[model samples]
Target: MRFTLRQLEYFIAAGETGSITHASERINISQPSISTAISQLEQELDTQLFIRHHAQGLSLTPAGRIMLMEAKRLVEQAESLYAAASEASEEVRGQLNVGCLTTLAPMVLPELSISFMSAFPRASIRPHADHQEMLLNGLHRAMIDVAITYDLQIPADIEFTPLVDLPVHAIVGESHPLARHSAVTLSELAELPLILLDLPLSAEYFTALFMKEGLSPNIAFRFSQPDIIRTMVANGYGYSLANVTPRSDTALDGRKVVRVRLSGENRPMTIGFATLKQLKKSRLLAAFATHAKSFISDAYIPGMVAPAMGQKKR
Candidate 1:
């Protein structure tokens, strides 16, 4: 079956946006054109790519999911080839699909993204913010070139390079008693109600901290978004644990939150890049890794505190 690159681009836009209309708007093409491209691609492949819903957006079938992954890789590769051909400079020129952890997106990604884009003006960088599981899935499926995230439960097929160690901080409301303290202990925090950040691997990390002290936190509320958890903690709902610390103490809702150091031998989470193990490192990927390391060393990324000047835990 012969499928044009234009068809794959339209299909990918629709699959990513989950709607033909949105894809049309995103790509500045007519809805009918996008629809026709999708239909032709599906007919060529002789398989259904999407489950159409009347009045609602479309959903990818199992085959559609597989196709989307391959389509993204192909589209990106084609773009890279075009970009390289258009520019004959010494600098590397290609597209990189980067992923960042949802919690770290606001704190760590923007500056690095801008710097990378600026350094390699000929190349394109597409960034996606998601949780660890989704980021890992994207990496496995070749949808994401490299990911900026914590050293979570990395599969054997993935490679992780640690850049900085972020120790967990205990967050509480300004009015809370523990807020005035410079540091708090797990056992001390265990007595208070906990507002858990119940993300896939993060929840386990926070819980394990308490378990090390032979105590279980009295979980009062649980949230997935870090900002929501911060807002709840600022509203005096309960104390929370987090590795990423915003530069400002104020929450999104204009409430004040305090960050206190955790007293004890709590293992710090390593922030790093994750990529497929056997995948060849493209020039774009190598450049990104090098710049990321330099950025951490230069202390240029805002809201991300530098690793403490002490012996790190192995």
Candidate 2:
């Protein structure tokens, strides 16, 4: 039936409150209007949804259960539409949605977000954290205006810009033998049980480091979450290689995990900004992108990096 969604809302409120008077009060409508709406809805559906009892409220029939579910869904959808409209923007003063890969968000976003707000005080930032593919899909669907992710598997619809290059370090428990060394050979890391990051590029880069020296890593485990892997390493589970050097005491916990130079292998995840190729960027988005790149270069990348690899950071 093509009845108005308002009818469903009224029915749901009446069903929930069990009183036409209460439903009218809740929806700010007159009791007579509420009763008429309910009657019209029941007539349209050709079902007795509520059984009216003398000197008491109403109760639902079995058919009412099905209608109630649909009514709730309609109400929810209506509320969502209302919210979307209320939160809509007329200029750069609207909502700015952004997505970033997990690895980059932890390091880059806190600083960049603050800078973006300073630049565009009117816009609100919504950030999503996901893998590279999800971030790209978000950009393509206009769910996100920008993303910060590893420079790998870029889509043609997205324009990639290098934010900075962070050096990949060999992280180990402070007590590990290599932790004392300023520089370590790949042959030294080969004998250790590797707790690897699940990124294919990372896996290949580390594996190649050992293979070039004709030694194999005793890989112990693979973990997707950096925090989980960091904890495992702190507990002396196994060694891992990563570019992110968490500078604060909170991240490393007073150097329980020591980050050292990866001497023989130079592998870094080139962090960067990306956006949709076809869509016109908002001033807010352009401002955020510029802020993000500058923030990374100042805070994370130690030296001036070579022009970033657009699709690969190997």
Candidate 3:
């Protein structure tokens, strides 16, 4: 039988306080009404819940203990409902779930989040890191408001905005022979074992550079995290070739790693925000996307230009 929450609450209050009189006072109900509610609950369950005495207060029977557990759970469920309702009422104060591809999240996301917080102080931005396909799936399911990812020619159902093309740099350990030089040619790095960020965009972008020069890359290691790649490079395990160099404190160990220019084949990765096309962009999402794009441009998009709306990057 479906039980109402009100009946469960009345039963619990009477059991806990050990006095129908006190339960009624706390509940702001008359003593008889509290007694009737408890009696009706017992009758519905066909169970004895209260052990009573004329001179002493009431105590719970075994059945009462079982009912008490259910009562507490019902109360908690009701409270959860209230909390959800309250959160739903506050505009720009609910949860904002977002997704970021492995490559873009590490570079400019920390600063972008800080700016978002300053602008929308109430909303909680929960960030999920994933590959491109997973991020796109989250957008379709409405699991994420927006996604920060590499620019791909995604489906028409999915909306993409090319915020900026980040200027990429070729980096190597300070101890590396090429680190002493201001720039290196694609042919020079071809013979060297290189650490590549095991991302499709990075792989496609950089490998094309080698292909253009009619040279193949000796890709020795493939890792997703830039920090891990930097560590590998720093320890002399291998050298890394990426579009964006470590620009933050967590990036490149100055003592061991240095970034140099690739004169002819330096490839820039296109990074931007993605969301479902039909989903009306919320003010918060629009604001975040705008700020996030600008932040990346200001910090990383050197010697590059932002294309007009509806225009693809060159």
Clashes of 2: 0
Clashing residue pairs, backbone N/CA/C < 3 A, model 2: none
Poorly placed runs, candidate 1 (over 4 Å): 1-7, 20-52, 59-77, 80-90, 298-300, 307-314
TM-score computed on alpha carbons, candidate 3: 0.62
Misplaced by over 4 Å in model 2 are 1-91, 199-215, 249-255, 298-314
lDDT of 1 by residue, 1-314 (tens): 59899899899999999999988875678999999999999999999999999999999999999999999888877877755664545466777888999999887787888888899886767778889999999999887889999999999999999887788889999999998897889988887999999988999999999888889899998899888988999999999998886667899999999888899999988888999999887677888899888886424345655554222311
lDDT of 3: 0.71
Residue lDDT tens for model 3, 109-177: 655666677777765576767777778888998767788887754777998887766555667777778
Model 1 scores what on Cα lDDT? 0.85
lDDT of 2 at 201: 53
Q: Judging by TM-score, tell me the better candidate of 1 and 3.
A: 1
The Cα local distance difference test for each model comes to 0.85, 0.71, 0.71
Ranking by lDDT: 1, 2, 3
On TM-score, the leading prediction is 1
RMSD each, Å: 4.7, 11.5, 14.7
